[model samples]
Target: MASSAIKHGELVALQELDSSSPLFKQGASLRVTGKLQEYCVGTAIATIVDGSVSLKIDTQHLRDLNFRVGSIYQFIGELLIQSDTDAVLQARVGRNVDGIDLNLYHQSMHLQRQFEVDYMRTRTT
Candidate 1:
């Protein structure tokens, strides 16, 4: 039977994992539930890589949900934790499910940044 809560991993605060701890390491699977922050609601999934958070949301989802930053989200998956470097957590993602796609997030971020730059350049005399 499938349980609503994550059985293999432990429930932990996002902030706690965001902090420094020996518990954070490679092969470490953690379950974190917190308000969505930093990413838009369209972000159905997200992941941690090199100590950075990335979203795995799509354009259709973005328009449908219109997610805003600072919203809460739940994360559960494995981490490639490393000392002296940021840990990367691969989140399981799906519609109404938990997970993250790093590649998608990077592409979105790049496009967004490019658009911003283009806008700024065009506005400049």
Candidate 2:
């Protein structure tokens, strides 16, 4: 039987959207944080950057949220990758995350993934 439980957004970095990452699955729910680089009010589109990676965000569903360029924000949404250089996040929710330490967050993200892998290896063995 198919589970009816709602799937929660998985935390992901923009860099993880590359071809090698498991989180590159289509329609996958994801939670990402980055600095807002630009926003087009007419088209309801946003551009956010994390380190050297930048991603387009479709903000049609999140019209209520205010997006200010140069502010840090976190977005939870569905991922859509059309090509190697084209990836968009259909954002469902977003909020400002100013004052967040991105460097520490990146380190924690790496540690979390390492722990998950180690835990899975133990379970399988």
Candidate 3:
């Protein structure tokens, strides 16, 4: 059989990861949105924050992309968890999303999860 194709990134909130939530698999591809808190050019690392949750992102592979602090951005990457309180994203793609309503997005994500759970339960019944 042919090898399975790569999966699309899963949309997630920083809070879910920072809180050490068991909602996603380790090293899973993720799509997260947050405001750029800071960036270290020398280290090629950037910090993005949503609410009280913050995550460090490795930007070494994204040298072509310019990151501006305080700007809202969405990133698709692989999640790397070193510990309960430490996690990093190896960014593969990024883009600005300054116009997005983060609160609404978060609420929708919660609803989506509920729907998925219900659908799965129905299927297994």
Candidate 4:
């Protein structure tokens, strides 16, 4: 049966392994989930997942979240965990989210310095 969750360091298949042939032979899809968690570097979302929290990520560019959440999103990119026992969703790419305990939220970290940053912060602070 297909699992509905992922763990901190476990590996899950976000995309079909049979698809990426030859050059891009990434081990069973890609370990983007764990790597992304590492990539964030001390981000709360990743930390939460490690602690069995829930999370989500904006994957419009990933061609996944553009469709659905959870089960549907699983087909887009990749979900990973260190082991099968851990009940945490590690979405490598998607909007809705799943697996890990924490909701792995993901938004485009746009360096929108040119998109009017000062005006927005000034109003909030």
Candidate 5:
């Protein structure tokens, strides 16, 4: 089985891991919690149920998604903080896990850090 990769500018649910936790470092397995609506670079605008938070991301490989407002999703992606807005996105990796796990994670050390071919749309071999 392969692990999924993450990106930027996507919404997610995060439950930060403790510093003592092994998954405290970058690229750790995180639990899905919620989803985000919009993200920029340095800061991201996200909502959780009836409330929301102004948080930061920890990755770069971003997969742009048009998130719906107040909707909760378990999407997994890289976390990024930009000058304008923060982002959670799908990143490229050696292992093959669909970037669209549509899941989320935690472990905010606060240190963090897509493309298409339709068929370039026709060969699944």
Candidate 6:
């Protein structure tokens, strides 16, 4: 199938050998796991180029999920698997746990500060 013919959200198997029409086919949702690598924060693009699959991720989403480079994640996301060497991921479901405790602690502190600011603003107004 022509890569252009594939819909934006259409799912295709990452491996060229996969030909199962039912379990693996076009437009089917698939969960893939891969390590995060080759990313550009300025462009908001991250790539997971593996032996069987390749994925592209939005760094903003990664940041929201506290994903870090060199970390592994599971993505239940949309795919445009054009070929064995070409594919794209539009979303993901999981993130890296490296430094997660520290990250969460910082996040909690930030949230507490925001809550305090909001409370003060409301009281003043």
lDDT of 1 by residue, 74-112 (tens): 455666654545565556521222354534544665687
The per-candidate count of clashes, in order, stands at 12, 0, 0, 25, 38, 1
lDDT (CA) per prediction: 0.47, 0.88, 0.85, 0.32, 0.36, 0.54
Q: What range of 10 consecutive residues in model 5 has the weakest lDDT sum?
A: 107-116
TM-score of each: 0.42, 0.87, 0.84, 0.19, 0.32, 0.45
TM-score of 1: 0.42
TM-score of 6: 0.45
Q: In what order do the candidates fall by TM-score, top score first? A: 2, 3, 6, 1, 5, 4
- Candidate 4 per-residue lDDT, tens place, 61-109, comes to 4432233212212323333333332222334443333454323322221
- Cα error of candidate 3 at position 122, Å: 2.6
Error of 3 at 31 (Å): 1.4
After superposition of all CA atoms, the RMSD between model 5 and the true structure is 14.3
Candidate 2 has its poorest 10 consecutive residues by lDDT at 16-25
lDDT of 6: 0.54
Query: Which RMSD does model 3 reach against the true structure?
Result: 2.3
Candidate 6 lDDT score at position 14: 37
Model 6 pairs in collision: 11-27
lDDT of 5 by residue, 1-125 (tens): 88564433232334432344343444443433443444455543333221344333332443454445444444344433233333333333212123333222233322221113434344553
Q: Residue 20 of candidate 5: its Cα lDDT? A: 43
Q: What is the lDDT of residue 101 in candidate 3?
A: 95
TM-score of 4: 0.19
